[model samples]
Target: MEILKRPMGDYQTNCYIVKIDDKEIIIDPGMGATEWVMANVKNPIAILNTHGHFDHVWSNSELQSQLNIPLYSPKGDIVLMQSSTWMPELPPSTPDIAVDGDKTLDISGIEVKFHHFPGHCPGCSMIEIGDAIFSGDFLFEGSIGRWDFPYSNAESMRESLQKFAKWTIDKPLYPGHGNPTSVRAEQRNVDYWLRIV
Candidate 1:
């Protein structure tokens, strides 16, 4: 398994391309990755979006059209995805597959598990492929996603954090922004941040 991160857009969102041999899966194809992914990543099987934030899904339509592959996002963030206030210039493109609940997807033999976490947005989630997790805005190096958006809920973030606390604390976490960090590191940070937030 090969995991590559390409930070893109004004926000410097982390766009990941996970490849296993010739099969590839893109997670969060943000702005500025359309040209790069079109040239480099080959025969992508699908796109797994962690959430519907504009910065995260900026290149969804471009990649989906060029690669002719399906894009999937958690069903809960449909509202945010469609709102121009949140999505900016990128008009909402309905995902081919809307992942509503916890399930495992078999993409040409590679297995990806989707777990809804809902905090940063209404339909926030984390994608688990192999031993790596595409956490989107959920867990960052020493911080969590912003829960101050109009659609974002502090209570939901708290609930998600509670569930996150029980998850295994050893996997690699690829966030939507910033450098990747381990679950153990974020777990400790979550403990400290939760007390103040």
Candidate 2:
């Protein structure tokens, strides 16, 4: 498996392209670099989002059109994805697949587990594929997501953090922003920042 990270737009959102065999899965294709994505993916199967925040989902429409792939996200975040004010710079696009908690999706031969973890947004989720967890805004390196937005909840965030802490500690987490970190490292020390929120 090959994972490529592209830092996109002003938000510096980490857009990931996960390639296994001849198929690819594009995660969070933010603004700019559509051509770069096209060059890498051959018969892209699905476009996955961790959440529907504007910065994270800005480029979905264009990329989806270009690649001719289905878009997938947690069911609850469709509102955020459609709201013009929330995602002002983004074009109109609805997810073809609205995933539920703990559901497994088979993309070609890769099995991706969707973990519903609502806190950052009502439909926030973490995508677990093999030893990697695409954790969106849920948990970052040495930090956690903020619960100040209208859809965000501090209690939910805390619970999500605690739940994540108890998860198996072997995978490397790829958050929406910042550098990647191990689950064990975040579990041991991320609570310090979560406590202040």
Candidate 3:
């Protein structure tokens, strides 16, 4: 499996293209991502969203139309997927598949896992494919996602963090922003956050 990454739009949201054999899955196709994705992928299969935040799914509709593929988004964030209270100018897109919490499925022959962690938003999740986890805005290098947003819940975030801290298996973490970290590395940070709380 080969993963290609490009940060998009003003937010510099990291858009990823996970290539497994000839099938490619687009994850978090943010603002200004359509052109880059179109250029890179030859046999695109699916578009997966970590959450419904506008910055993370700006180019969702365009890519869906162009690539003619199904979109899998978190069921909890379905409201955010259709429209955003924060960004009314956001292009509205519909999800072909509304993924429930902690679900796994096969995209063609490849395994796609969605680990639900609702805190940053109603349906915030981390997508796992192979040995890497695409932790969209949840677990970053030295920080965690903010629960100060419109639909964000601090208590829920705390719960999610606790669950995350209990994880024993280590994997490469590709976050929404900044450089990549690992499960073990961020477990230490989770410990820090838990300590202060």
Stretches of candidate 2 exceeding 4 Å from the true structure: none
User: Which candidate has the top score in TM-score?
Assistant: 3
Show model 3 residue runs off by greater than 4 Å.
195-197
Q: Give every collision pair in model 2.
A: none
**TM-score of candidate 1 on Cα atoms, chains taken together:** 0.94
RMSD of each: 1.4, 1.5, 1.0
lDDT of 1 by residue, 1-197 (tens): 99888899789999888999798899988888887777768678998899988888888887878789998988887666665674567756679998996879988898899988877888888899988988899888888988998778888888888888888648998899998888888877766757755
TM-score of 3: 0.97
Rank all candidate structures by their TM-score, best first, as comma-separated numbers. Answer: 3, 1, 2
TM-score of each candidate structure, all chains considered together: 0.94, 0.94, 0.97
Worst 10 residues of 2 by lDDT: 83-92
Q: Best-fitting candidate, measured by lDDT?
A: 3
Clashing pairs for model 1 are 77-123
Error of 3 at 47 (Å): 0.3
Q: Which residue pairs in model 3 clash with each other? A: none
Query: lDDT tens digits, residues 1-197, model 2?
Result: 78999888888989999987778889988777576688888779999999888777777888888778899988888888886565565776699998876689987788999988888888898898877899899888877788899889888877777787678657899999999998888888756856676
